[model samples]
Target chain A: MRGAVMHAPGDVRVEDRPMPTIVEPTDAIIRIAATCVCGSDLWPYRGLEPVAAPQPMGHEYVGVVTEIGEAVREIRVGDFVVGSFFSSDNTCEICLAGYQTHCVHRGPGAASGGQAQYTRVPLADGTLVATPGQPDADLVPSLLAASDVLGTGWFAAVAAEVGPGKTVAVVGDGAVGLLGVLAAKQLGAERIIAMSRHADRQALAREFGATDIVTERGDEGVARIKELTGGLGAHSVIEAVGTQESMMQAIRATRPGGHVGYVGVSHDVSLPGLELFFSGVHLHGGPAPVRRFLPDLIDRIWRREIDPGKVFDLVLPLEEAAAAYRAMDERRAIKVLLTV
Target chain B: MRGAVMHAPGDVRVEDRPMPTIVEPTDAIIRIAATCVCGSDLWPYRGLEPVAAPQPMGHEYVGVVTEIGEAVREIRVGDFVVGSFFSSDNTCEICLAGYQTHCVHRGPGAASGGQAQYTRVPLADGTLVATPGQPDADLVPSLLAASDVLGTGWFAAVAAEVGPGKTVAVVGDGAVGLLGVLAAKQLGAERIIAMSRHADRQALAREFGATDIVTERGDEGVARIKELTGGLGAHSVIEAVGTQESMMQAIRATRPGGHVGYVGVSHDVSLPGLELFFSGVHLHGGPAPVRRFLPDLIDRIWRREIDPGKVFDLVLPLEEAAAAYRAMDERRAIKVLLTV
Candidate 1:
């Protein structure tokens, strides 16, 4: 099988790799249909994060089950499925409470890079959600999105408490942030403010239900949000960028007693205890529990109620994984789809 | 009139001061029945915080209304009342959202030292809640407690989402944390863990409805809490100490979906964003909109349903404030009541 491997920062190559076998009793092997380059991937590709050693890349995936371990009762071969980034027992107290990502018996859902011919999925029944029958070709990308970005954006909206009559501000322009606009609109937020300096991203943000746009960054961006919301700031703020500036902007852009749902994967950010204390805002976010919302999301995608797959702007064959990484790292693509 | 003023870190003196007057139309003057040295007071008294100038000391009080400005309508002269630390319009959107401490038209409720013969209270109609009636001599201290500590503790418990069948862990043994135990019990929490090493404080915690006790601090305390909760952590954790260690312990002791309600005044703490993000706990707190809980807290104290006044272990005349500060600074007293 061919897999994308990064030997060091700024180095990615598609090469032949060994076939993955089910090592866990509750595992299943899936033949990959499609996978994508995630914004998080850029952290290491750009050398912002340390690359300890050569490692496989890719977590978001959609595929058809090719084989199943004897203990895997729910998932069977030939069934098309979307899998969350993290696997869990699905019956732990944390998983039952909608925090499957923090389950007591959690496993890396994607043991082998999904940007390959085949991959091993642990806790198959708990990690993979079968599509309502085989999804149409046009629905593949959207279903693949349900495995990560769409579900993550949905969790951000839910954590922000975006609801009817709320004024929501989003602080990122990546695929996740654009999809957050869609989620906020779906959640009934009255006004959606997208803070983006890029024209193309702004257009997509608007198309995804952003009612307003502020092309400012940092303190200026927070000021724009406050000015737009009668000087009280937004009722909900979604932080999709993990940088220190974006985190501060998100926290400062929310009204007292409002919620700030941050999904940015914090990096080098130290929140001053004094300012956060005086802000009087609720803070809740971390790794998204995508598994919890996979079923509903798949249903919505199948019904064509949402078209989130548009986030992908570049598409290529699995052998062109290096080009996909380059396009994303250089901001030439919002997200790149790799067909396996 | 006489007031307590801190001229330096270890210097507190009770000296003659001009009588307070209602300066704003929303102001009221009150003849204090009693006031107490708070746990926060020790910060500056022990030089943890700089004594910028000869500032008046005290932000909590229960007293009889002496005079009122023309706009003060809801409260009457000679009525006994309990007041919050921060004054607010009580009509602003923030206040309506139960965040009165962050009110748009907020003012310092204790304009004059509350540990004085008489003090000025801003936004009288919003900050002062008249008790059902004048209470017997024995109820004075308890009613005073409701003005700040009890109200603060109640807000912390509310922020932590304490409810029926929830397990609560309190991370401070001060008056506010002790009262948090009481508030949790009143809110129907199933198990209350008080983290305190002092025997006297532990006894008070037990009296306030602590079901268990953990004497360990920092990581060990978090470990003990995890052991008690089947290694998943508690459902709700109340943080009443503002130190870095206490904050981290509180966050670590809460389960992934649990809440951390912090009310201690932050001094020099900075929370590492990565750990907080990965903790997956809901964090909500700040100066603790005590005014939001004042009415209910007063009712409970008035009905003799709780005895929060027991937190005050030392009683002294206003002239002995220096000794009172020293006692609290040296940990010789849990709290010291300053009788006018």
Candidate 2:
């Protein structure tokens, strides 16, 4: 089987690798039908994070179950499924509380990368959510989106408490942020502000229900949000870029007592306690518990209520995995879908 | 009029000062019946925070309304009132949304300084909440507690979402943390863990309905909390100490989906973004919007449902203001009440 591996920063390669096998009683092997390069992948590729060893490259996928362990009762071979980046037992107290990403019985499942021909998923019965039936080819991309970005964006919107009569401001223009606009609209936010400078992304944001666009950064962007919100800042701010500047901007853009739902994997960000203390904003975020929202999101995608797959503007064959990484690294694509 | 003045970090004096007069149309001059030394004031007295000049120092008071400006409508002269450290207009959009501390019309009102014979209160109509009538001398200490520490602790408990069937952990054992225990019990929390090393404070916590007590710090403390909670951490955590260690402990003590409501006046605390991001906890704090809870807290105090004023262990006459500050600084008193 072939899989994507990173030998070092900026060196993603498609190479022959052994096919994954069910090693545990609750494990299952899935034949990947679709996977994609994510915004987070660029972190190591761009050398923002150290790539000390050759590593598996991706964590988002939609696939068909090729084999299932004896203990996996809910999932079986030949079933199409979507799984979250993080696997969970789904029976633990934490999982029962709707925070499956932090399941105490199991560790983060993303360490077992999904960018491969055949990937083994641990705790299969609890992690994988099957579609109603075999999804058609056109539905594959959307289902793949639900594996991470779309569900993550939805979680960000929900954490931000976006709802009727609320004005929401998004602080990033990546695929997750773009989908956040869609989620905010779905949640009935009265106004949506997308902070982006790229023309192409701005257009997509507008199409996805962004009521306004701010092309500034940091203080200027926060000021613009305040101006648009009648000097009180937006009622909710979605932070999809996890940088010091973006986090500060998100905090400043939200009105006091508002919510800041930050979904970006934070890097080099340190918040001064005094500043955050005086901000008077509710701060809640982390790795999205995508498994918690997978069922509903898959249903929404199947009904064609949303089209979040549009974020993948570039598609490449799995053999061209290096080129896919480059496209995302150079900002030439919002997201890249790789065909298996 | 006589007032408490901080000549330097460790020097406090009671001296004659010009009496305050109404400066704004909504301002009121209150003749303080009682005031108290707060834990936050120890920040500067211990030289953790600098005192630039000889500053009037105090923000907690129960007093009689001596005079009211022409525009003051809600409060009248001779009314026994309890007001927060931060005066809010209580009618702005932020106030209407229940964050009166961040009222759009006014910022933090700590500059008014309540440690005086007569102090001017800005936004009188919104900032001051009067009791049913003048109370006996014995209730003065309790009413004064409602002015800040007790209100702050109550807000912390509320923010942490303490309720039936939940486990709550308190990180500080000062007057505020002690009062937080009382608040959690009043909120019907099933179990309350009070972390304290002081025997007196521990005894007070037990009296205030603490179900468990842990005298540990740092990783050891976190380990004890995990051990007591079956390794999942508490459902709610109240942070009453504004330090990196206490903040991190509060964050670590809460479960992934739990809440940390911090009311400590943050000093030099800096939170690592990645740690906070991965923690998956809800974080909110600051100078509590005490005005939002004033009505309910006052009603409870009036009906004798809660006795938060018991936190004050040392009482002194107004002339002994210097001794009051020293007693709190040396940890000889959990809280100091000064009668005017």
Candidate 3:
């Protein structure tokens, strides 16, 4: 099998790797059908996140199960499925409480690497959610999105408590943030505001049901959101950029008693206790329990109810994983999908 | 009129002051029935919070409305009422959303020196909740507790989402934290863990329905809570101590998808964003919108269903407020009530 590996920062290479096999009674082997480079991947790729030794890349995947261990019951061989970055025994207490990302028996999906021809998945019955049927080829990207981004965006929206009568503001214009606008819309938000500077992303944001777009950054962005919401700030704010500035903007753009659902991978962000305490907003987010939303997201995609795949503006073969990483790092693509 | 004023750290004087009069159309003058020193007051009195020029101290008050401006509607002269630290116009959008503390027309109740014979309350119609009848002398302390500590504690419990079957951990043993245990119990929490080291405070906490008492502080306290909850942490945590240690313990003691309601007046605490993000806990808190819970609380007190006033362990005349402050500062009293 061939998979993308990074020996050092900015050194991504597709190299031969041993094929993965089910090693646990609850494990299953999946032949990768689709995978993608994530913004999180850029952290180590850009050297912002340290990389120790050569490591396989990619945690997002939509694939077809090729083999299953004895204990795997719900998921079977040959079924197309979507799974999250974190594999969990979804029946665990934490998972039962809708936070599979913190499941007692949780493990990273990148252990065997999803950006490969074949990968081993632990806790297959709980981690993977099968579509009603093998999805149409056109729906593949959207299904792939359910593995992480779309479900993450949905989690952000839900955590933000976006619902009917809510005015939602989204910080960060990445694929997750753009999809957050879609999620908020689907969740019945009365208005959606997308904070973006790029013309292309702004257009897509509008297409995704954004009622307003603000290009200002930092304090100005917060002030603009307040101005648009009658000086009270939005009812819900989704933060998809984990920088201190973005976090403050998201917190400041939410009204007292509002919600700030932040899903961005935070980096060196120290939230001032005084500011957050006085903000009077509910803060909830983490590695979104995407597995919790998989069944519903897969159903939505299967029914063609939402086109989450629109987030993937660039697509490449598995061997072009390096280019995909570059495109995302350079902001040339919101998301990039790789066909195996 | 005589009011308690902090001239400097460790310097409190009950000195003569001009009688308060309704200055705004929405204001009302309250004849102090009972008022008390608060934990927040210690911040400035101890010089942790700045005390510039003999600042009038105290914000918690339960009193009789003696005079009202033309615009004051809900409160009438001779009506016994309980109000919060912050006076808010209840009709504001923020107030209507149940965050009256952040109301657009909000003002500090301490501005007129609540620890005085007479004080002017702004937004009288919204800030004050009238009791069904004049509360008996025995209920005065409890009613005063409702003015701030009880209300704050109740808000913290509500923010923590304490309800039936929930395991609640309280991170402070002060008046507000003790009251939080009572609030959680009243809200139907099955198991209430009160974190306290003081035998007296612990006894009071148990009396207030605390099911368990953890004497350890900080990390050890969190570990004790987790151990008690099968290593999963509590479903709800109320943080009433505004220090880095207490804040972190509250966050760490809450399970993923659980809620942490923090009402402490945070001073030097800085929350690391990455750790908070990974905690997957819902955080919500601020100045308690006591006005939002005033009516319900008043009714409960009227029915004699819960006694929140037992937290006031010391009592003194208005002239001895200096001694009252000293007792609380020396940790000799949980709370001090001052009578006019």
Candidate 4:
């Protein structure tokens, strides 16, 4: 099996590797159908996050179960399934409370790297959610999205408490942020504001149901949101970019009693406690517990109620994984899909 | 009129001040029966928070309305009232959403300094909640507690979603934290953990309905909380101390998907974004929307359902305001009550 591995900065390669096998009683081997590059992957690729050792490259996937350990009960071989970047027992108190990403037993599945011909998944019964049946080829991309970005955006919207008559502001124009707009719209937000300067992203944002677009960044961006919100700021704000500037913008753009749902992998950021305290907004974030929303999102995608697949602006063969990373790294794509 | 002023750190004095009058149509003047020294007062007194100039010194009080502007409709001159540290026009959208502390029309009532012979309250109809009748002298201290500390503690409990079957942990042992324990109990939390090092404070915590007590601080304290919760963390955490250490403890002590309600006046604190992002706990804070809880708190105190005034261990005449500040600053008193 050939898998993508990063030897060093800007040096992602598709190389022959041993096929993954079920190693634990609850494990399953998945034949990758689709996977993609993520914004977070750029951190190490750009040398901002050190890759001291060769590392396997992707964490999002939609696949078919190829084999399962004897103890794996719910998942069966040849079943189409979608799982989050983190695997969980789902029965633990934390998982039961809907924070499967922080499951004590399974740890983060990102390190297993899904952008491969085949990958082994532990805690299979709890991690993977099977589709009603084998999904059509067209629905594959959308299901793959539910494995991460789409589910993440949905979580952000839910965390921000987007609902009827609420104004939601999205701080990033990336795939997650754009999908957050779609999620907010679906969640019944009265107004969705997408802060983006890029014409392409702006157009997509509007198509995804953004009622307003602000081209400015930083303080200007917050001011614009306040201006649009009648000087009170948006009732809910989604932060999909994990930078100091984006976090501050997200916090500052929410009303005193609003909520800020952040999904970006924070890097080099420290929030001033005094400002956050005085902001009087609810803050909840972390790695998205995408597993919590997989079923509903899959159902929605299957019913054609949403088309989150559009976020994958560029699609390529799994063998061209390096190019996929480059496309997203240079901002040539919102998200890249690598079909196996 | 006479008022307490902090001319500099540790220099509180009772001096002649102009009589407070109704300057705004929505204002009402109250002749204070009781005021108290808050934990936050020590910040400026200790010079940790600079006192640029002589400043009026208190924000918690229960009083009788002595004068009302023509436009003050809901309150009358002879009414006994309880108000929060921040005045609010409860009709604003924020106020309507139950975040009156962030009301748009009125300024922070702290500037009016309730530790005086008379104080002008803005947005009188919204900020002042009249008691059913003039209370007996014995209830004065309890009503004054509702003016700030009790209301703030209640807000913390509400924000933390304390209720039946939930486990609540309090991070500060000051009057507010102790009252947070009381609030959690009143809110029907199944268990309350009070983190306090002092024996007296721990006793008070137990009296306030704390089911468990941990005399640890920092990481050790968090470890103890986890130990108590079977290696998980409390479902709800109240952070009544504003230091970075306490903030992080509050966050780390909460289970994933739990809530941390912090009301301490955050000072010189910066929360590492990565840690907070990964904590997976709901964070909500600020100067509490005390006005939102004033009515219910007043009713409860009036009915003798709770005795929050026990927190005030030292009582002094208004002229001994200097001693009250010193007693609180030196930790000689859990709280200081000043009678005018």
Candidate 5:
């Protein structure tokens, strides 16, 4: 089997590796049908996060289950499935509470890594949600989107409490942020504000349901959001960028008592306790519990109620994985899908 | 009118100040019946916040409406009222959305100090929630509690979503934290964990409905909370202390997808964005919008349903406001009431 591995920053290579096997009773081996380079992958690729050894490069995938361990009951061989970045035992108290990302039994699931030809999905019954049937080729990207970005965006919108009669502001133009616009709209937000400077991304944002666009950043962007929200800030704010400035912008752009659902993978950002305390905003975000939303997202995608797959503007063969990483790192692609 | 003023750090004096009068069309002048030194007042007294001049030193009070401006409608002269630290025009979009603390028309209401014998309440119609009628003397302390501490504690519980079948951990043992225990119980929390070292405060917490008391602090406290919750943190955590350690403890003690409602006046606390983002905890706090809960709190106090005023361990005549501040500063009292 061959899989993407990073020896060092900006040094992605597709190397032959031993095939994965079900090592645990609850594990399932999935033959990768589709996978993609995630925005978070850039953290290590750009040398922001040190890669001590060659590491698996992706965590979003839609695949067909090839084998299952004895304990795996719900998932079986020859079934199409979408799994979250983290594997969770759905029966755990935490998973039952809808936060499968922090499943106590497995810790955070991201450490497992999902960018490979044959991936072992632990807690298969809980971590993987199967589609109603074999999805069409056109539905693959959207289902893959549900594996992370779309579900994450949906969680961000839900966490922000976006709904009818509310104005929502999104901070970031990445695939997740773009999908957040779609989520907010689908969730019934009356007004959607997308903060983006790129012409192409901004156009996609509008098409996805952003009623307003602010090109400014930081305090200026917050001010613009406030102006649009009648000086009170938006009713809901989606923080899809995890930088300090973006977090602060999301917090500042939300009205007092409003919700700020942040889904960005955070980096060196530190929030001032006093400022956050005084802001009077509800804050919730982390490795999104994508498993919690996968079922609904898959259903929505199947019904054509949403088209989040449009976020993947570039697609490459799995052998060209290095190019896919470069496209995302250089901002050439919002998201890149790799055909396995 | 006499008021407690902070001339500088460690220097508090009871001095004659100009009587407050209606300044805004919506303002009302209140003859304070009771005022108290708050934990936040110690911030400036200890020089955590700068005190440039002799600043009026209190923001919590229960008073009798003595006069009302032309625009004041809901509150009438002679009405006994309890108001939040910040006056808000509750009809504004922000206020209607339950964020009166950020009402655009009135701005942050901290500028109107409630310590003076006669204090002018801006946005009288929105800020002051009157009791059903003039209450007996015995209920004054409880009503005063509702003016800030109790309301804040209630807000914390609400923000944390404390309710039936939930385990609630309170991070502070101060007046507000102690009241949080009561709030959690009233909201139907099955188990309330009060983290405190002070024996007196601990006893009070238990009396107020803490099902368990952990004397540990910092990481040890978090461990105890996890141990109590079967290795998963509590479902709801009330952060009544705003220090970094307390905030971190609150965060660490919450289960993934749990809620942390912090109402303590945040001081030198810095939250690492990545840790908070990965924790999967919902964080919401601020100077609590006490006005939003004032009516219900006052009603509960009037009906003798809950006794939050027990947090005030010492009482003094208004002329001895200096001693009241000293007692609270010296840790001899959890809270001090100054009777006018």
Candidate 6:
């Protein structure tokens, strides 16, 4: 088997590696059909996060189950499935409460190291959601998106309490943020505002149901949002950028008693309690419990109700993972699909 | 009129001040029947908050309306009323959303300078909620509690979504925190854990329906709460202490997907974004919109269903405001009531 590995920052190589096998009685082996480079992957690739060793490079995938341990009952071999970035037993108290990402028995190994020919999925019965039937080739990217990005964006919208009569402002233009606009629309938001400076991203945002676009960043961005919302700020703000400036802007761009749903992984961000307190907005987000939304997302994609696959503007073979990483790091692609 | 003024930290004195009169078309003048020292007041008294000049020192009150401007509608002269710390025009969009404290036309003058013989209240119809009728003398303290402490506590419980089958942890033992225990109980929480070290407060907590009391602080307090909840933390945690330790404790004590309702007046607190993100709890709070809960709280107090006024352990005449401040400063009294 061949998989992408990072030896250091800015260096990704696809080389022959040992194939993954079911390590737990609940695990299953999947032949990777599709995978992608995620925004989180850039954290280490850009040297912002440490590269400890030659580490496996992906945590998003849609694949066909090749083998399953005896304990895996719900997921059987030959079924095409989508799995989240974190594997969970799905019966733990936390997962039952809809926070599968923090499930007591959550293990990242199952869904990670997936940019390869084969990968292991732990807690298979709980983590993988099969489509109604084999999905068409055109629907592959969207289903793969349900594995992480689309579900994550949907979670961010839900966390923000985006619903009918809400004015939603998205704080990032990445794939997740673009999908957030789609989620807000699907959730019946009255207005969707995309904060993006790039012409291409703005067009995609508009295509995804954005009613307005603001290119400003920082305090100016907050002020613009307030201006658009009659000086009260948006009813819901999705923060997909985890920088200090973006977080503060998201908080400030929400009206009192509004909600700020942040999904971007935090870096050196420190939130001033005084500001957050006075803002009077509900704050909720983390590693989104994508597993919780996978089934519904897959259904939507299978039904062709949403086209989240549009986020994949670039696609490359698995062996060209290095180019995929560079394209993402340089902002040349919103998301890149890697075909195995 | 005589009012309590703080010339500097710890320098509270009863002094002659101009009698308050209606200054806005919606203003009403009230003869102060009762006022009290709040935990927030202790911030300035303890030199934690700056006292730039001789500032009039109170924001809570229950009194008889003496006069009303032409625009005042709901409140009438001779009506006994309970008002929150901030006056808001209840019809505004923000107020209608149940965040009166952040109402667009909010004015502090209507509620502040209340530790005096007479004070003017702005937005009278919105800020002051009249009791069903004039109440007996015994109910005055409880009514006063509804003006701020009880209402704030109620807001915290509501924000934390304290409801049936949930485990609630209260992080402060002051008047508001004690009232929060009562609120949680009234909200149908199956188990209420009151975190406190003071025996007197612990007793009050138990009386307010605390199912368990943890005499631990910081990490130990969080650990005790988790241990009580099968190591998953509480479903709802109310933070009524503004310090960094109390804030972090409240966040860390809530389970993933749980809620943390913090109503403390935040001071010098910085939250590391990464830790808060990983905690995966819903954070909602700030200076509670007490006005939103004033009516219900006053009704409960009127029916004698609750006795939040027990927190006022000391009472004194208006002229002895200095001594009242001292008792609260030294922790000799949980709260102090001043009568005019």
**Share of reference contacts found in each model:** 0.89, 0.91, 0.92, 0.93, 0.97, 0.86
lDDT of each: 0.92, 0.90, 0.93, 0.92, 0.89, 0.92
Per-candidate interface DockQ score: 0.88, 0.90, 0.93, 0.92, 0.89, 0.90
| lDDT (10s digit) by residue, model 5, range B219-331 | 99999999999999999999998888989999999998999999987888999999998899999888777888887888788789998989989999888877887898889
| Pairwise DockQ winner, candidates 1 and 6 | 6
Better of 2 and 3 by DockQ: 3
> What lDDT is reached at residue B331 by model 3?
92
Model 5 agreement with the true structure over A1-340: per-residue lDDT tens digits: 8889999999999988888887889888888889999888899999999999989778888899999999999997999999998889988898898988888876424234566777888888988999999999999999999999998999999999999999999999999999999999999999999999999999999999999999999989988998898788998999998898999999999888899999998898999988898889999988888999999999999998888999999999899999999999999999999998
Model 4, A119-185: lDDT tens digits are 8888998899999999989999899989999989999999999999999999999999999999999
Full candidate order by DockQ, most accurate first: 3, 4, 2, 6, 5, 1
Candidate 1 on A60-179: residue-level lDDT in tens?
A: 999999999999988889999999999988898999999999999886778988778899999999999998788899899999888889999999999999999999999999999999
Q: What docking grade does candidate 6 earn?
A: high
Best by lDDT: 3
State the local distance difference test value for candidate 3.
0.93
lDDT of 6 at B127: 91
After superposition, candidate 6 runs with Cα above 4 Å error: A109-112, B109-112
Clashes of 4: 0
Q: What C-alpha lDDT, on a 0 to 100 scale, does residue A191 get in candidate 2?
A: 96
For candidate 4 chain B, which ten residues in a row score worst on lDDT?
A: B105-114
Question: B1-340, model 3: which lDDT tens digit per residue?
Answer: 8988889998999999999877889999999989999999899888897877888888999889889999987789999988889989899899999999999988896558899998999989888988998889999999999999999999999999999999999999999999999999999999999999999999999999999999998888889999999999999999998999999999999999999999998889999999999999999999999999999998899899999999988999999998999999999999999988
The better-scoring model by TM-score among 4 and 5 is 4
Q: After best superposition, candidate 6 residue B221: deviation in angstroms?
A: 1.3
iRMSD in angstroms, per model: 0.6, 0.6, 0.6, 0.7, 0.8, 0.6
Better model by DockQ, 1 or 3? 3
How many pairs of residues collide in each model?
0, 0, 0, 0, 3, 1
